[model samples]
Target: MCTYLKNMEGYKLKDLKLKEFDSIQEMFDRAFKRQKVKDDKETTELKQLMKIILDEEEVEIDVIPLAVKSPSIIGWKIRKEGRKSYYQIIRADGKSQTYMIFSHMLKSFDREDLENLYELVKAKYESTRPVEDLDLILWGDLKTMFEPHIEDKVWKNQQDYKVLNWKLYDSCGVHSLRMQHVQIYMLVEKKYPLTPSTLTMMLEKKLMIDYESEMAYQLLKFIMK
Candidate 1:
């Protein structure tokens, strides 16, 4: 855990009260004022990610869980010239979600293209309606958004593509397939309307269902028709 976050852990945003809120605002103000022009790719990425969380229009209690990831980046001391910061992501869930998110950006995107990618992601996420299953939506949709710009390193292995897809889905928030499948269906349907048989084949081969999940079953059926 970052030392700066030790005092603030588990403190949900809604319960901040006046004093606690002020303290966090102070921390954010300090971070903002001292923000520098970053030269390195990693630092720049961290800065942008943190900004997306901190700059949200509304802060609520549930946001604390997602917001906790912010301190991990600031702790790296990336803002200070010449000093490299390493983050030790600690989570009780036996998974370092923040590190996974950061690593996905570093590994799957070209250093030069991360800013563009993050901006597009942030915009798309903000514009979309939040759903109970945000990951499903984001991951499936990301295939369309990111298919064009995958780093050469990432494309070397097809499985890496799947890994990056899921990582972004999990980190971004809840998932659904609303926008993703809609976009795909629209694109393909304009050229060729999917026949019932073709859609059934897609359900069998393309859609990976562990069991007979209702959402998966319905989505495949809907797409085909």
Candidate 2:
């Protein structure tokens, strides 16, 4: 834990009462400002980073378990001056279910992103949603919303062809097909069509998710006729 966090002796993470905040921006302001390290050199840096994260409307916070392996860290860091800040992550489940991490950004918090995070937390004051949902959603959706040029890193650029890749069209009102190898059936509703293969790649390649999981299979089946 950063020395700044330690001295907020009375302010437990849960006691910070973040559930009251209706927006991600509000939650971040409360979380960042409850500082035990007011005098630290990194205080201003953290404040600035918090602002950058909050200004976005569609930011998603993903809390990786303490044991998960991390990918590369990139983005602005004033402390390091245009370099990625590096730190070790440490967690202990035995006490207070506390998770701790060291990094430019890591999920030291215990909760991950739930689809109904606001809803679940508002009702139960705790969310039971699986953390895997966060991993799948944030790595793709959050990147789409906040990070710049993530599409180039994930899927082929469609700029030259002026086309959308991996499109799905419903067929026969019974099943859907990936447009490339699809057989069109009943063309009644003219909406909600799907293609299994293209949809699979949309979730797999575009989302950077694996194909073997039951969730992946189910999503594919739902899209295919």
Per lDDT, the best of the predicted structures is 1
Compared with the true structure, the alpha-carbon lDDT of candidate 1 equals 0.33
- Residues 55-98 of candidate 2: C-alpha lDDT, one tens digit per residue: 21222223354355223222111122153322222223321111
lDDT value, residue 213 of candidate 2: 35
lDDT of each: 0.33, 0.29
The runs of at least 3 residues in candidate 1 whose Cα sits more than 4 Å from the true structure, single-residue gaps closed, are 1-96, 99-201, 204-206
Q: Which residues of candidate 2, in runs, are more than 4 Å off? A: 1-82, 85-140, 143-211
TM-score of 2: 0.21
RMSD of each: 23.8, 25.5
Clashing residue pairs in all predictions, respectively, total 9, 13
Please provide TM-scores, in order, for all candidate models, with all chains considered together.
0.22, 0.21
